[model samples]
Target chain A: MRFDLIDHAMAVTGAIIRVLVYSILTLPAILVVMSSFTNGETMSFPPTGFSLRWYRAAFENDLFMTALWTSTYLAVLVAIIALAIGFSAAFAINRFSFRGKAFLQGLAFSPLIVPAVVLGIGLLQLFAWLDLTQTIYPLLLGHLVLAIPYVVRTILASLTLHDQQLEQAAMNLRATPLRVIRRITLPLILPGLLSAAIFAFVTSFGNVTVSAFLTYGGRVTLPVQIFAYLDTSSDPLVAAVSSLMIVVTMVVILAIERLIGTERLA
Target chain B: MLAPMIILLTGFLVVPVLGLLRSSFLSGNHLLEGSGFSLEQYFHFFSDSYYTSVLVETFFDGLVVSLICVVIGFPTGYSLARLPPLARRWRMIIVIMPLTLSLVVVVFGWLIILGRNGLLNSLFVSLGIFASPKILLFSRPAVLIVLVQQFLPFMILSVMSVVTQIDPVLEQAAANLRANRFATFRKVIIPLAVPGILVGFNLVFVLSVSAFITPRLIGGSRVAMLGSLIYERIMAELNWPSGAAMAFVLFVSGLGFTAALNALAASRFIVRGRRHAL
Candidate 1:
């Protein structure tokens, strides 16, 4: 009877703690969502009242809109470029037995672990030294490096899970290597590729540290813009923009969850 | 096929990082001529109390966060890993959502909650716990809380991966031996789960040390970290050389710590394997 009571008490305590921690994890986002509808300028808890004024203000502001367009285009471009290369690398790694293969894998994945600050500044100095235009190309290149690792990781997992006998049979049928890739391999991993593209797109879109050093000449990414905005303004406008981002993130994560199992993401 | 990948990595990734290395060794502040090779910039970081302290703070912050991550995340991950298949999938989605979202976007949530007239402060006032709303923003502890929230998923996933691989029979056997839940967890579960715990520790440590946004937004000027310090040097002072040096310091140290932990994990695995053989 005593052991049962203690066991029940401990279980209840654990449940309470877990619930508390999960609340801490999820509540701030809920607070932001609720606060964005504030009718007043002051950002107060429980909000000052309900209104869409800040959402209106966010769209009205040129900085936010311009940055929004900039981020969208860059992210789309980054997704396309990173996916193309990462797909090729994943294909090579999965199919081939070659020297320096481990080296290549390390090179591809290094950017994922390396601090973005170092990579960002390095790319900046490289571009400045080369005297190339710093606005678009360098930005693409910097984000490309950061996005490639996730692309490779996801595509590789897909490739490994897939039965290679299909590809082998295609090859035995004397299908051209390129045609085999086009016909057999590509279709099999297309969903994974899409997920990888989504991963790359989000990574590039959300990037700020690299964008910080790289952005100038009226082409700041949305994150960089939001960061700068917070320096001068603390109104409901920031909340409004943040809420929109939350909605978009929610949508994307759901879409991704449907497209590929959430396990691929982790 | 390999040509494009190689070109992308070598041209855009490898060469540029090499450029950063060269710049870090340069004598001058700005990325200009008279860039004689010098270690003065490295010395500058070590010489100043301000710079060294930030370095200390960065590592200490990482240590505390990693330890907290392991302590908090282990049980959560164990629970998730032990769940039924359907519940596991649903729980994973919630765990992954925060990781998928922008750090900047998520930090915005923290910004609102930790603001002067924010949720916790209001709760305190409403409950009559305090006479007034407390200023919780722009402090290290404030940032630390958010950091744990942000990086907690990585730790959880790390633990889950290993815990899932661990055979439940081992626990059953321990129970059959009349060991209680606590004893089974301490004797069997923890020993088996050390690899995962170490992986989670290494990951959380690397990430927290390298993180820029949480400290910037949540802690702000009040908490000086290596990331923010490097940002200020590069952006405000336009000191690429100094910034590059600091950045390298962070990178190399993070890598070193990772290597050390890997070695530790490997040695333990070997020792355990030998013991099992006996």
Candidate 2:
């Protein structure tokens, strides 16, 4: 009886600790959302009153608007390009048996292991050396490097979950190789491809460390703009902008949950 | 099919990193002006006390943050694994939502929470925990807190992945063999969870060690870390050689730590496999 009582007490303690830790993990986003509606000119906790003036301000600020557009455009391009390359690479890795297969796989996933700061500085120097610092190519290439790893990892997981027998069966049924891929393989991995695109988009959009180094000619991504803004000033506009991003990210996450299920995501 | 990816990686990643390495060995501040290969920048890094301390502090910060993540993440992961599938799915979303948000947004949230007259200060003052609002922002502790928040998800996910794979039958078997809850946890659970814990440790360590924005914003000029230092040198000071050297150091240490952990994990799995065979 005493042992059962002790076990019950321990379990309760563990549950309480879990709740506290999880709360801490989610506290920042909750606070940012709460403060975004502040009526005051400056950001504060338990914001003086509820209003959406900052959101209006964030939208009206031309610098911020341009950054928002830039970020979205860049992220879209990165997602499409990363998906095309990642899908092909993942397919080849999953379906082929060839020499240096392990090396190719490792090289594809290598960016994840390299610190973003290192990659950022390295690319900054590389572009300077190539005299390509004046264009948008540096930012695009840098983000692509960061986004590819996640895309490959996601598509690889998706590819591994389903077997190749279906592709083989299509081939056996007198289907052309391209036809088999178009009819069988593409449809089977549609969810994975979608998930991979989402991953690439989010990775590119949320990037700051790499973007900070690569932003040039007065064109900055939204996150880097926000970072630079915070360095100079503190205002509720940032809170509003951050809250907007939180909503967009929540939508993306919900989409992933719907597509692949969050369990697989974990 | 793989040609495009291989070409992209070789052109961008490999060539750039090689350029970085080459620049680190260049003698002068300017990359092009340096005539011959030299170790001047590395010598400067090691010979200078200030720079050496920053390296030490960076590693110290990584170790502390990694340890805290393990301490907190293991329990959370265990609980997450124990939850019902439906409940677990919702909780997992909440856990992962912050990771999807930009690091800047997350750090901004911390700035508000830890700022003077911020939520934490206001709450503490109202409860008489402190007589007045305290300066919580722009401090080392604040940076550490935010870094942990930023990277904790990685640790939790890693641990949860492994703990979910542990067979419940073994735990039940331990219980049926007269093992107490503590005994089962200490014997079966800890032993099985070690690999996950190690992987999480390496991840959090590498991440927090190289973290830039969080430390730059929260710690400000008061707390200097290698990541921020690299930024200042490369961007603010235009000292590319010195910056590249520090970046290379960060890269090598991260790779070395990961390799050591991989070796350890491989050996552990081998022992576990042998035991299973027996």
Q: Which has the greatest TM-score?
A: 2
Off by over 4 Å in 1: A1-14, A169-174, B268-273
What DockQ does each candidate score versus the true complex, computed on alpha carbons?
0.55, 0.70
Chain B TM-score of every predicted model = 0.94, 0.93
lDDT of 2 at A47: 93
Candidate 1's DockQ is: 0.55
lDDT tens per residue, model 2, B152-193? 888898899899999999888878887778777777887788
Question: Residue A23, candidate 1: how far off, in angstroms?
Answer: 2.3
Q: Which docking class does model 2 fall in?
A: medium
lDDT: worst 10-residue window of model 2 chain B: B269-278
Instruction: Please list the residue runs of candidate 2 whose C-alpha ends up more than 4 Å from where it truly belongs after superposition.
Output: A1-9, B261-278
Q: Write the per-residue lDDT of candidate 1 for residues A58-132, one digit (tens) a residue.
A: 999998988888888999999999999999889899889999999988888888676777788788778887877
